[model samples]
Target: MHLDACTIYRYSSYFIRVFTHIYWKSAEPCLILQKNPTRPIALDLQDIHKSYGSLEVLKGVSLTAYDGDVISILGSSGSGKSTLLRCINLLENPNHGRILIGNEELMLKPAKSGELQAADVKQLESLRARVGFVFQNFNLWPHKTILQNIIEGPTQVLKIKKRPSDRCRKIARSRPTSKKKDAYPANLSGGQRQRVAIARALAMQPQVLLFDEPTSALDPELVNEVLAVMRELAEEGRTMLIVTHEMRFAREVSSKVVFLHQGVVEEIGTPEQVFDNPTSERVKDFMASHRPT
Candidate 1:
């Protein structure tokens, strides 16, 4: 797929500055944040609510995730963090709300039969398909090789042909810095397995990538590898949203850090703004008490 050349070039230049800054004081980890009111919003969620039986997980919530935003949603377990993500993807429908992705209308609270058009579903599904998801557990197929796992989603779901030489293609695209050429999931380390899972997500040619605790399942030592890969993706300027507990990674990599409390967006702002001077006690308490494990 062809990307915007100018945008891609800027993305590369930004990374160059990042590495150059590491070597000298010439460049200092520049983060050019934009709160441009004119930029089109990428995602819009309004009056979102989810309930399971007697339990109400998400109260009415509204937020906008804008273009070129790399956001991290941090909250304790049972805070409706994952469920909110599910609602975004339509994996779990919101009780009452409208989710607009670009120009398409996604979620529906079930209007009268003739009230909602069937074409809305198609438009929304197409939109969802463009967004890739990385699960907490590396959900790679045990039967397929690493290369096979990477290309299978594009082949099966997107109806693209899987090349016989896809193993080489995967390596070329991933540019694996390590030497595990033809390894399977069982033979690969936790980090490598997660990398394969990530490669699979990228092979689908997604516009936005959503990571749900991508490194939570890995051991402490292996966590850095997965985080490093994510950092590289951010450098590539891929629009991404992540739900994670890694505060250091959040501070280092994300443009916007959102503190979700009780399913509501308590605070959302730049990492330094939120980290250095949090306005909400809920967020300050949450940050003060929880250290990376």
Candidate 2:
């Protein structure tokens, strides 16, 4: 019952690590969702390719999103859904491709192994700011309180002042704020953490928001809470790219649905076209397997 300071510290450290593991998984994945492009094109990916050694993950994958476009990239595991999203946000550079945001294209230089990279760090940072990304596991910092996490990007990266973020206020209104605004991630539930993650992305005021399996990490009961927030955003006409297995959500929310097979765009069209009548054998087979009971 009476533990030494060292023993208490060790237990605390172990609990933090274990809790973080349970709540936040690895952070990289691909999902391209577009909102109303303030410009002609919000986010464009041209013939993107990514390979790990000889195994090519993304092969000639091209995506184009315009104003008010909610495109869902759907596919089975290993179909390169996540890889595609990673490339767009530059989390993982594509072996070869061109990424354009608005009227400006990303400047890149050839890196080793035929890959491409941002010509300069400043350019990459600038581009990332315009594109918001929400990971499956809410990547909120365990040490920082909810408010601190939400405002970090705006103040640090975008050089925004300490003025309150709209998103933070929105989230705060959802629940009674008995805890300090600085309440750590450990104090929040899965759905709350994911909401904070969304707020963090929205605070940047991204032109296009990318969600990589946003609801996959939540408990079945918690999934709807996160999805509701996303739905509200979609209703507000935010451009979103979601890579998910939530077929119903995709069909209901997205204007266009893209099916990727073996790293290539297999089928793409309006949800009705892709879901109701899939042309490709690969898509037909995939849908058949995933059809709800």
Candidate 3:
């Protein structure tokens, strides 16, 4: 019996899902859900610092996002906005910091090179699965159809079964790409592709979503399409940390606006305070220059 690649992949995925489900189910009692009853913190970064060789990118940056908070991180170029977002999921590991998702701290151990590394690979993987990240560039597989791209994470990394994965795919499609489910990524427009990226992240059903300048790569006209989807997500009360240059959108949607200056938090306040009545001289200057007319 000669099995084709697709057939083999399907069977293998099924077995992996079944086995993982059973294993995790048996281990459920050992898992702890650490959450504060009064004020639940969705994501926390404490004194995060990251450097490249001699150049420091992030300098003791700290941020906290409560449940349902839409935090928009604003800054001038080279202020480590994207670096900070990437550090949340350890895509670029911070040299020193504490990161917690839902009060569960990510375990890290110092390496010989003086960099922090995940102490337990399994724990890191588990925590990473809970945080979804959307990039500036729409990172989609050119060969895969929209449906396949959306379901890939849940079915593979999450070990979700076919039925549940399909459900997730449906939800994702409904949000962003319903009309183009069967189309390959190459066939879609830039806006459509970015929406697909968002849908792909949504299909993972992450507890917290990170947007690293998601609209930066889109054309001026296409930028709003991506922003509109993001606004809907914000309205749905999803906990999101957005690193964006869209000042108007940030002013309109953010529960909290953070201004990063020279790798440190220059200011943090409500959108009204940050945009309309900023206290810091640097923040005031930034707002004055970048504020949409």
Candidate 4:
């Protein structure tokens, strides 16, 4: 018996849905009801396009992230990988596109120059608060201690009062903590800083986490510590969108992979399809070039 690609995808998707329903129902009956048992989309980007003057960065890119999905975006530099991630959280206003978070459409207005702008500032902020972004440079405040940095977003944006001991428990408990929880960024190693950055994002209790080359700045020795934390998050079924050069991590962790080349989506599918049976020549070459010698 033979099955076409579409048929195979459909079957696989159905199996996943069934498995998820059973697992969640058994693990947390209350959450399954609150999250809508059938299907709940966490994030949606429709026909996203961004241009810098005459140079188009992302062209007609669309992505949908279902609850508990980890979609990894891969490409060489200048391939618009990071730009797509930025557009999702409105850090870069897409020239033309629509965004939705959990079935709620974000309001947008057309600018005189024909670019789309958020119609309401407050609405945009509220929408952004739901999506947590982790940048390549662990953008922690230099003067703030690790604990201070972690709680800052919750205090300001989420209006969460600090309950020092409880706060520590809410964020990742297993990650390495400083002997003095108040050590500044300068005092922490690269891995520790990035882990703190992840904890900061988690403190917001976001619907989704967006990671942009999260480990690129760290020394080779420190990358694994950060990756371990990410792996733990993935296991606990966090909805994530990671733009990374860590192909091995992507292959092992992602539910879906999107390959962008020169501002267009070159290939997208499950890890097996994208990595093992890529249909695009550009993706084939890109993977080949990245292979370790």
Candidate 2's TM-score reads 0.82
- Compute the lDDT for candidate 3: 0.77
* Number of the candidate with higher lDDT, 1 or 4: 4
Taking the candidates one at a time, how many backbone clashes does each contain? Answer: 0, 12, 0, 0
Where does model 3 exceed 4 Å of error? Answer: 1-37, 163-179
Leading candidate by lDDT: 3
Candidate 1: list runs displaced more than 4 Å. Answer: 1-32, 107-121, 162-181, 291-293
Error of 1 at 238 (Å): 1.4
Ranking by lDDT: 3, 2, 4, 1
lDDT, candidate 3, 1-293, per-residue tens? 44322333343322122111111112111111122346688999999999999989999999988887888999999999999999888899899999999979999989887778899999999988889899898889988987677667767887754564345444544442345666798887777788778777776667899999998988888887677677767767788999999988887778888999989999998887888999999998898899764
Q: CA lDDT of 269 in candidate 3? A: 85
Q: What are the per-residue Cα lDDT tens digits for candidate 2 across 160-189?
A: 544444544554444444254557888888
Q: Tell me, by TM-score, which candidate is best.
A: 3
1-293 per-residue lDDT for model 4 (tens digits): 44322222233322122111112112211111122346589998999999999999989998888888888899989999999989876788789989998888889988887678889988888888889899899998998876677667666776644355454544324433425356788987887788778877776668999999999999998786687677657767888899989887787778888999999889998877888889999989988877522
TM-score of each: 0.80, 0.82, 0.83, 0.82
lDDT-superior candidate, 1 or 3: 3
| Candidate 1 vs. true structure, TM-score | 0.80
In model 1, what is the error at residue 51, expressed in angstroms?
Answer: 0.9
